[model samples]
Target: MNKPLLELKNISIKYDDKLVVKDISITIQEGEILGIVGESGSGKSTLIKSIIGLLGEGGHIVDGKIIYEGKDITNLNKKELMVIRGQSIGMIFQDCQSSFCPIRTIGNQLYDSMKAHMKVTKKEALERGEEILRELNIKDPKKFLNSYPFELSGGMNQRAGIMMAMASNPKIILADEPTSALDVTVQAKVINELMNLRKKFGTTIIIVSHNMGVISLMSDNALVMKDGECVEYNLTKKIFNSPSRQYTKELINAMPKLKKEII
Candidate 1:
C-alpha cells in the first residue's frame, strides 16, 4: 500500500460550456479504501465517470492527467481503455439493477462476462459465479442465478452487482453510491462485503457516496466536495473531528445522531 495505484492530477471535467469538476486531484494507494462524499450534483459521479471514460456524450476531461499503474490513461484509444476496464479496474454503479439486461437471467450475463474476460467454459463460469454469490451471502445462489433481474429484490440485485464486479478479481474497484438504495441493515452488509474483498484480494477501492456515515465505515480517507471542487481531503478522523472547512464541519453536523462515530 505504499505506492499510489491511481492518481488524478488537477483533473477538470466539463459538459458543453458548464464546468462540473474543477482542478480535482487525489491519490489512491494500493489496498486503500477512499471515500468521495458530496451533495447531489457536486460532480462525484462525474469524477468517476471521467476516470473510466464513460462520460457519455458532451462530457470531456478538459485538463490534467489520470495515472494508473504508472501509466497515463488521461487519453487512451478505445482498445487501450477496454484493456484496462473490467480486467484491471471494476466499477459498481448506484443503480446496480439498471446495469443488468432486463431480458437476461443472472447466470446468462455472468457466464458471458466470465467468458469474455477469462479462459472458462460456460459451465465453469456458471459454477464459479454461483460460488462467488454464495460467498457474498446471497441466498440460494443456484435459484437466484436462474432468476431474471426483476425477479429479485433491489438489495439482492445490488449485491449481485457487487459480486459481478469482484468476480473478475480486478485490482481496483470503484463503487458509485453502491448502498444508497438499500435500507440501513442491507447497507451495512454491502459495506462489510466490500471490506471483506479488500482483506481477501487486497483490492484498492474508491467509494463515492453522499452519506458521511457510510464513508466513515467504508473508507480510511475522505474527500469532501462541493460545487465541483474539493472542500477538504484528509484522513477520515480529521475530516470528521477537525474539518478545516466550514462546509465539511456542517456535513459532519448534519450526519444522523446514531452515526456520531463518524465525527
Candidate 2:
C-alpha cells in the first residue's frame, strides 16, 4: 500500500471561543480525489481552510495535527507556512473574487504568483501562464491576460483562479465549492477540468461541496460531515449506495435523478 499524502489527526477548529469543527480525522492518498460534502455551515469550508492555514481572523485549530508529505505543519511559523501554502499546498477559495486582486491585470496576478515561488523571468512567466490558460481552453490568452478580473465572466474567473493555484505545481490542492457559482453547463466544464488537472499534474485533490452528485462523479472516496462532525467516510460508491448516516441518505435523495427515456 502507498503512504497517505496528507493526514489530519483528530483535528478540531474554532472561531474565537466558539468551536465549530469537532474532533475529526482524514487521510488522502497520493493522486486521489477526496470529496467532502455537507450542507452550508456544516464546517466543510472551514475544514479545508484549516489545512492551508487560512482559518481567517479569530479562528484557529484547537486540536490535533496536520501532517503533509511526512511533516507536522500544525504549528509552523508564518514564514515556513507560506513556503508550503501555495508551493506545496494550493487552495481554491469558495469565492473566486476573493482569490484575485480586482485592480490588477489577470496576467500580472498569475505572473506575480509564479515569481513568488519560482525563479522565472517575466517572459518565462508569461509563456507558462499562457500555456496553462490555453491548456484549460481559455480563449485569447493575450487579451484575457491583459484584462482585469472584473472583465471576465464568473466561469472564466473561476478557471483563472485554478490557473493561479496550479501555477506552483503543488502536490495537493484544497478546493472549496469550486462549482457553486456557475451555470449547469459551466459547472460541468469546471468539474471536468478539475479532474483533468489531477491526470495532468498527478495532483492530490480534496474538494468541498454540498453536491453529492459532484462528489460521486469526482472523487474516489467521500467524507460526509454534518454540524462539524463526521457523518460517514468511505468509498464513493458505498457512500452513494449504502450511506451509514441519515444525513448522507437525505443528501443523495435530494439530487435530481436522471430518468431513462422510453423507446
Candidate 3:
C-alpha cells in the first residue's frame, strides 16, 4: 500500500491545564476521506484543529507527533508551519462567514490567497480563481469575482470558501462540519460537492461532523469520539452496520428519520 499522507500518532490536546483530547491516533491515505463523528463538545473539533495548528489561545498540544509527507510537523516553527497550513493543508471551518473578509471582493480574497503562496500576477490569480469557481459549478464567475461576501447566499459563500481552499491544491483538507449551517437540501449538495472534490483532485479529507448520514456518505473510515477520547474507529460500513462501541450504536440510533423503526 502507498504511504499515508497524514498521520497523528498518540495526539493529545489540553486547554488551560485541562486535558481535552487524549491519545488519539489516525492515518489518512491519499484520496481517502476519514470522518470524525461525535456530538458537540466531543473534542473531535479539537483534534482537527490541532492537526492544522489552529487551536485557540490557551490551548496547547500536550502530546504526540503530527507527521505529514514523512516530516514531523508537531514542532515546526511559525515560518515553516505557515508554508504548510494553506498550501499543503487546507481547512474548512463550520461557519463560512467567519472565514471570509467582510470588506474584500471574493476575487480579491482568492487572488490574495494565491499570491501569498506563489508569485502569480493579478491576471493569473484571477484566472485560477475563475477556474476553481467553475469547478464548484458556480455560474457567472466574473460576477462572483466582483461581488463581496454579503452579496452571496450561504450556499454560494460556502462554495466560494471551498474554492479558496482548493485553489492551492493542498494535499490534505480538514472539513469541520462544512455544511452544518445549511438547509437539508443544500447540505446534501455541499456534501456531494466535497466528495466530488476528492474525486477530481485526489485530496485526502478529514471531515468532522455530527451527522451520521453525512459521514456514511463521504467517509471510507469513521472514528467516533465521546468526551475527550475516541471510542470507536472502523471502516465506515462496519461502523454503520456493526459498530464496536455501544456509544456509537446509540449515536447511530439517535438520528431521527421519518421511516422510523424500533431501536
Candidate 4:
C-alpha cells in the first residue's frame, strides 16, 4: 500500500495561549477526499489552517507533528513554508471574492501566483490559467481571465478561486467552506467541479465545512469534530449510517431529509 500523503499526529493548536484544538489526528491518502465537519468554534477551520501554517496571529501549534510525504514540517520557517504552500499544497478560502484584489485583473493575479512558485512567464501562466478554467467548464475562459474579481458574480469568483488554487497542480487542496457562501445551485456546481478536479488530477483534498450534507456528498472519509476534539472518524457511509457519537448523529439529524437522501 502507498504511504499516507499527509498525517496529523495528535495535533493541538492554540491562540494567545488558549487551546482551541486538542489532540486532533487524521491521515489522508492521495486522490482521497477527507472532510472535517463541525459547528462554529468547533476548531475545524483552525485545524485545517494549521496544516498549511495559516493560523494567523497568536495561533500556534503547541504539540504534535504535521508530516507531509514522510517529512516533519511542524517547525519550518516562513520561507520554507512558503516554498511548500502553493507548489505542494494549495488553499481555497470561503470568501474567494474577498481573497482577490479589486484592482488586479484575474489573469494578472493568477500570473503572479504562478510566477511565485514556477519559472513560467506571464504569457505561459495565462495560458495555463485559461486551460484550467476551460477544464472547469467556465464559459469564455479568456474573458473571465481578463475580468476583475468584482466584475464577476459570487459563483464565478468562487470558481476563479478554485482555478487559482489548482493552477499549481499541487498534490493537495485545502478548501475551507468553499461553497458555503453560494446558493444551492451554485454550491452544487462548485462541489461537482471540485470532485471533477480530483478525478482529473488525482489531487488529494481536505475540505472543511459545517454542512453535514456537503461532507457526506464529497468525502470518502469523515472526521467529526466538536469543541476542538474529534468525536468520530470513519468512512463517510459508516459515519452517516452508524455514527458512534451523539454529536455526529445530531449533525446528521439536522440535515434536511432531501439532503440526507441525496447523500
Candidate 5:
C-alpha cells in the first residue's frame, strides 16, 4: 500500500464553545484527488482551515493528530507551522481576493512568495511567476502581473490564486471552491486546469466544493459531510453512480446533467 501524504486521525475542531467539526479521519495519498462535498455550514471549510492551523484565537484542535509525510505536525510551533504551510502544503480559499494583498501588486506578491521560500533573485521570481501564470492558461501574463487584484476579472483572479498556491511545488494543495465565481465556460477551463495539475506535478489535492458535477468529474475519492459529520465516503464513481446514503443520493440527484435523449 502507498503511504499517505497526509492523514487526519480522529480530528476535531472547536470554535469558541461550539464543536464545528466532529471526530473525522481522512488519508490522502500521493497524486490523488479527494473531493469533499457538503452543504453550507457543514464544517467543510472548518476542516480545511484546521488542517493548515488557521484556526484563530477562538478556534483550535480539540483532539486527534495531523500527520504529513510521516511526521506528526499537529504540535509543531508557530514558526515551524509557517514553514510547513505554503512551503510544503499549499492552500487556495473560496474567495480568490482574500488570498492576495490589496496593497501589493500581483508580481510583488508572487515575488515575495518565491523569495521567502527559496534563495532567488527578484528577476528570477518574476520569471517563475509568469511561467506559472501561463501554465494556468492566463492570457497576457505580463499585463496580469502588472495589474492589481481588483483590476482583473474573477476568473483571472481564480487562476492566479491557483498559480500562487502551486508556486512552491508543495506536496498537497487544499482548494476551497476554486471556481465558484467564474462563468460556466471559465469554470470548466479552471477545473480542467486543476485536474491536469496532478498529472503534471504529481501533487495531491483536496478540493472542497458544493458543485457535485465538478467533484464527480475530477475526483478519485469522494466524502460527503453534513452537520459536521462525515455521512458517506467511498470511490468517486461508486459515490456518484450508486450512493449508499440517502443524503449522498440527494446530492447526486441534484447535480446538473444534460437531458437524456430518446432513441
Candidate 6:
C-alpha cells in the first residue's frame, strides 16, 4: 500500500494558551478530495491552517505531528515552511480578494508569486496565468489578468485566487471555505470549477466548508467536526446516508432539499 500524501497524527491546536482544536487526525491520498465540515468555531479552519503553518498570532500546535509526503513538518521554522507553502501546498481562502495587494495588477502579483517558486519571465507567467483562468471558464482571461483585483467581482476574484494557488502546481490544495462567501449560483460554479481543477491536474484537495451540500458534492471522504472534535469520518456517501452520530444526522437534515408537490 502507498503512503498517504499528507497525514495529521493526533494534532491539537491552541490560541492564546486556550485550546481551540482538540486532538484530530486525518489522512489524504493523492488526487483525492477530503472535506471537513462543521459549524462556526468548530475549529475547522484552525485545523486546516495548522497544516501549512498559518495558525496566525497566538495560535500554535500543542501536540502531535504533521507529515507531508513522509516528512514531519509540525515544527518547521518560518523559512522552512515557506518552501512548503504554495510550492507544495497551496491555499484558497474564503475571501481570496484580500490576498492580493490593492495597488498591484493581478498579473503583477501572480508573476511575483510564480517567480518565487520558479524562474519565469513576466510574459511566461502571464501566459500561464491566462491559461489557468481560461481553464476555470473565466471569459477574456487576458483582460482579467491585466486588471487590478478590485476591478473584478467577488466570484471572479475567487476564481483568480484558485488560479494563483494552482500557479505553483502544488501537490495539495487546502481550500478554507472557498465558496462560503458567494451566492448559491456562484457557489455552484466555484464548486464545479474545483472539481474540474482536480480532474485536469489530479491535484489533492482538502476543503473546509460548513455547507454539507458542498461537502457532499466535492468530497470523496467527509469528516464531521463539532466543538473542535471529529464527530464522524467516513466515505461521503456513507456519512450522508447512514450517519452514526446525531450531530451528523442533524447536519445532513439541515441541508436544503428541493420539494416536489403533487396536485
> lDDT: which candidate is best?
4
Q: How many residue pairs clash in each candidate?
A: 0, 0, 0, 0, 0, 0
Specify the poorest-scoring 10-residue window by lDDT in model 1. 254-263
**TM-score, candidate number 2:** 0.94
Per-prediction TM-score, please? 0.94, 0.94, 0.95, 0.97, 0.94, 0.96
Report the lDDT of model 2 for residue 220: 96
Residue ranges of candidate 1 with Cα displaced over 4 Å: 258-263
Instruction: State which candidate has the highest TM-score.
Output: 4
Q: Per-residue lDDT tens digits of candidate 2, residues 1-263?
A: 78888999999999999888998899989999999999888899889988878888998999999998888999888878788975899888777876799999988988888877768887777777787787788878888889899999999999888888888889998898887887777777888888898998898999998777788888999989989998898999899888788888888888745101100
| 1-263: candidate 3 lDDT, tens digit per residue | 88988889999899999999999999888899999999888898889988867887988999999999888999877777778876899888788877889999999988888888767888887888888777778889989989999999898888888888888789888999898888777888888888888888898899988888888888999999998898998899998888888899888888745112111
Estimate, for each residue in 131-181, the C-alpha lDDT of model 4 and write its tens digit. 889878987999999999999999999999998999988999999999899
Candidate 5: worst-modelled 10 consecutive residues by lDDT: 254-263
Where in model 4 is the C-alpha error above 4 Å?
257-263
The CA lDDT at 62 in model 3 is 90
lDDT tens per residue, model 1, 75-192: 9887777767768888999998999999999989988776676677878877877877876887688898899999988889888888788777788999999988987777877888
* Overall local distance difference test of candidate 1: 0.87
Tell how far residue 87 is off in model 1, in angstroms. Answer: 0.5
Backbone-clash count (model 1): 0
Please write out the lDDT profile of model 5 over residues 157-235, one tens digit for every residue. 8887887888878889999989777777777888888888888889889999888888887899988999889998889
Q: Rate the local accuracy (lDDT) of all candidates.
A: 0.87, 0.85, 0.86, 0.91, 0.84, 0.89
- Note each model's CA RMSD in angstroms: 1.8, 2.6, 2.5, 1.2, 2.7, 2.8
